[model samples]
Target: MLAESPPETEQSAPPPVARPRHAARAAGLLIALAVLALVAVASIAVGAKPMSLDEVWHGLFHYSGTVNDVVVRDLRVPRTVLGVLVGLGLGLSGAVMQALTRNPLAEPGILGVNAGAAAAVVSAISFFGAATLDEFIWWAFLGAAVVSAAVYALGGSRSATPVRLALAGTAATAALVGYINAVQLMDTKALDKLRFWTVGSLASATMDTVEQVAPFLLLGVVLALTLGRPLNAMAMGDDTARALGAHLTRTRILSMTAITLLCGAATAACGPIAFVGLMVPHLARLVTGPDMRWVLAYSAVLSPVLLLGADVIGRVVTRPSELQVGIVTALIGGPVFIYLVRRKRMAQL
Candidate 1:
């Protein structure tokens, strides 16, 4: 006799969500959005100088120009807005990257985008005497785009596999990082200018910085949101995606462009923020159950929640002195990432 079939439950896949489930997911998205709003407000209100809710309200609408108002207008608002935009870009890019590669471990920086940006920024300060965000931001974006294109060519161009692309990106990142290290070590002036940015805190956030990056981030968001259905189809396999009219070449090209825009601008504005891109998309998938559409939506909203929450936590945890936001995220995310890796199912998600 043939071996007994495995239990049906063991092989069963998750079913498509019903209307009720969709409604629930929608409600959850709204809740996540509300949490993001609260976190953004907290970022503004709960700094070294904590402000009351009433003060925060006045700081927003009224124009008394008090010390508190100046602090809010000049400092907190820019930081909060930059955090939101950067967080949004990171999360969406990560989700798109993972979907494009069909690799659960992929992130926004998996393409060496951050490394490219940092190298350019450092070179600007060291060799070109470009200190301000205005001058260096453009350099960073240019470097990121150029490096990513080089990585793509090395990864096999049109015939690139996920593994090849990842390997190419890794090699590029290591080389770029070495270059950045050499530059910073040789120039103390560059090191002093870069110290804050390299740590990935929002301390240097300015309205000008936010204004420079916002358009790129918003355009990236629109492009990313459009790829959801195509990504979902591609997740089933390239053949299946092609069968479903997904146009694999077009999707992949668009995905790369969007990732470059999103990651480059975020990195240029705020430096390389660790773990926001890596961790948020996995959490989004956990909540949304692998539907790329819901995954993208949830990531867009929830990533900012995590980033701003981490920023706020960093602010209050050390009192007068504070931890950098990147440090805080790495501290929290490392353990979570270990836990995720240990769970066999998470790698498949």
Candidate 2:
């Protein structure tokens, strides 16, 4: 018995483990925010009629010098605000769309939201001669809603597949573009208006236009944020989500509504700007991982950075003459899109 007791076996313990990765992600997000702030300031200060740092400071708060004050307050400030709104809307909507469809390439522009809004605007201009921003805004909103509903109805089954949604979106986009082209061919006056708006310049932005669309954008943003957790749950497939107590159909419908409002307001404000929606979400995901919370936050900050930076570049590249923000985004986003496709990663969605 004593000999048997002496032969007690030794036991082993598990190795020490690493801390959670979320803390590191939180730190990175803080850094990203700081960088975004710096870029925003640079965007505000370095416009066509270059303002010194001191002038920017005074203009923002104190308000001195007629020219500096007007430039900063009237022109740059409104444009920058719109940029922030548009970026937030596009980024958040893109995130929701991607999550809902489980597709990385899904964006309002790519999925016919922009095309729908644009078609509506074109029809408004061609048929009704609606020249005011307010008139066009309503039409754009209606068009966006219709197209979004169509996309969902066609592509969303008991289990919504990304490929089917994409195909439906593509078909809708093609039809809308064809309609626009036909109108442009027939009506030179409408073509003139469409030519400028289609390129997406922020130059025409005014306080009135900003005010008109701000409520819609704000509502959409709030909905998108609230839906983030649900969307994350939904990404695990509809059946799994249902088992997890998530309402699949309700979530999809609400998400689509939010996208319609966000995309509609953005398109109404800045005419059919492409690629920001598509590019910003992917870029945000790369930085913040797959979490919708982080993705939306990064998008809010980064989208304005891209849109405003593009706008500033547009102002400077041609000096007295300026390129459109839409053109700039297209030039940059098109190549990036191709690269993503060539890399074979985007197709995984």
Candidate 3:
């Protein structure tokens, strides 16, 4: 006791481990936000028609209907805005989907959302002769909603086991893709039109398109952010999540609702862009670790960075002929996906 008393000098406690992680997450989120801003500006400034930073600023703020002003105001602004919205939707959907399925590889398409939307749009083009994107948008949304609901109903009928959900989605996606292909093959006009639509790009983005999808996206995002704690618990496993007082059925329904809204709106607006959802969330997880809240937050910002940056690159690399955002994303995502597979970290989640 005396020896212990002699050695009882005060020692400072070390900082909590979580503090550094939280700090790093905050710093990463800020960097992602900054990159998103930079990429968005680049999206506006470095399109098929170039514009200086000053011209972009003037066009955005003070426009008197000059050519540059028209380009910036009418074209790039909507396109850029749509990119941000679509990216956010896809990114959030992917993160939610992965947690819901307990599969790291899950994306928006895993639920047949994109395939269902594409099939409906293709049918409209072929049989219904819907000429414009605006005309077919309702069909796309309906298809996505129906397919997603069906997936959940089938998967959760007995129990919302991950295997059942994934299998249902895969089967539905295969069927939808088959229908889309059959329609496109039978109608040349549909093929010509659907070709552009299927590849997915912001080339046709307009203020009307942005406005139409904005409300759904906003609602979905608000709802999605609220599910972070539930998702984090779910990531540990259903039993653990339930033991932690999370309502499994309620969480599943809410997650599906959020995914349906976000994916439906995104596919409707931008015509089924791929891989942004698959890749962005994984990248987010790499930075933010297993905390679903941080993963979602990081995804929401960095997804736009990837999308806008890819779009900008597509614009510049092709000069007069730009690649679609979907194509570019696939090109980028394939390698990233492969790397993730090789690393085996994705196997854990």
Candidate 4:
């Protein structure tokens, strides 16, 4: 036999853990982008007066004086852009809310951010006659801030739990909604105006609205991403996170600020669209594992896909009469949410 080498000393080799998480995230992101592209193309091609793909492509790139060019540029373009912005804001805000509360079900709507923004807008419209978009922005921001403070105050203790925050948010939402309904009952004109807004449409989006809200969205996205590392640390439990050198109070405050600005600006721009915030983060987590960094990034990409797809669906299903994006999302998200609940997967967070 060939001289056997002396027994090799055992060197510890790191275990080869599965790379499923990274691969899954990459695949999910690719899927999201593909869906977004498909929706955008469909949105341009399927409308009251349908356009050929060639026409749509030419209009988008070359700006030929075609019917598709006018429709895509003037109408669908603004709506699509607004959808992306709003989705990004909602997705990021939702992820932040879930992290802060340590609750998978935590969303802007669940935590009263949307209601607060809506209440502020209604008040501004009713009291100040703020017919313009610019006038409503500040009021919405104030409302979001006040409501967030109230939620924190009501639920926050030396140690607050997700259940407590949810309860407080529920109570606050019910009271605010009652007040809004009362106002609507008393003022038919306000009701008429609010009806369109409460349903959430991107039809009114303008370049000015986009510009006004972009800064907030950009800041919120940055803050949300920055907080991801801290959020992951915090998920290990507050005491553990503290031991790991995470500043609990600062993280919470910063997360709240980011969410408030994002949700408020989105609400101000497009009214209070729902479900994207609630659903997208959970979906992202399912795909990306529990790591907040990947979850946040995936949510940022995927949320727009859902919103734009819903918008496109809304545009097509009714032919000339389009459905509101809010309605479509609620319709689609409700069943998916129920399925998640039934599977008991929603509580994983």
Best by lDDT: 1
The best candidate in terms of TM-score: 4
Clashes found in each candidate (C-alpha, N, C closer than 3 A):
0, 0, 0, 0
Model 2: residues with Cα > 4 Å off, grouped in runs: 1-20, 54-58, 61-65, 152-164, 345-349
- Please give the CA lDDT of all the candidate structures: 0.83, 0.81, 0.82, 0.81
* Cα RMSD (angstroms) for every candidate in the order listed: 6.8, 5.2, 4.0, 3.9
lDDT per residue, candidate 3, 193-287, as tens digits?
77777878888899998998899888889889899999889878778989999998899889988888888788878788777888888888778
* Residue-by-residue lDDT tens digits, candidate 2, 1-349: 4554333343343333323466676777787668767766766787777668888888888876688987887778788888878878888888888887787667787788889998999999999998988888889989998887787678784455666877888899899989988998898988877887876878877788899999999999998888877877776767788888998889988898888889888988888888888898788778767778778777877777788889889878887778888899989988876665466446433
Candidate 4, 1-349: lDDT as tens digits: 8997655554444344646656767787888888878776675566656777777777778896676788877777777788888889999998988888777667777678888998999888887788877777788889888997788678774355666777777788788778777777877778877876776778777777888888888888888889989999988888999999999999988998899889989999988787788799888876777889989998998888888888878878897888888889889877865665466444635
Estimate the TM-score of every prediction.
0.87, 0.87, 0.86, 0.88
| Candidate 1 per-residue lDDT over residues 1-349, each given as its tens digit | 9999988987684566677788899999999989988888789888878789888788888959999898888899999999999999999988988787766656656567778888888888888889777787688778877887787788787566666776887788889878877887889877877887876888888999999899989999999999999999988887888999989989988998898889888888888776677788888877888899999999999888888889889889898887889888878877875675477665433
Q: Which stretches of candidate 1 lie over 4 Å from their true place?
A: 1-17, 149-174, 346-349
The per-residue C-alpha lDDT of model 4 at residue 152 equals 65
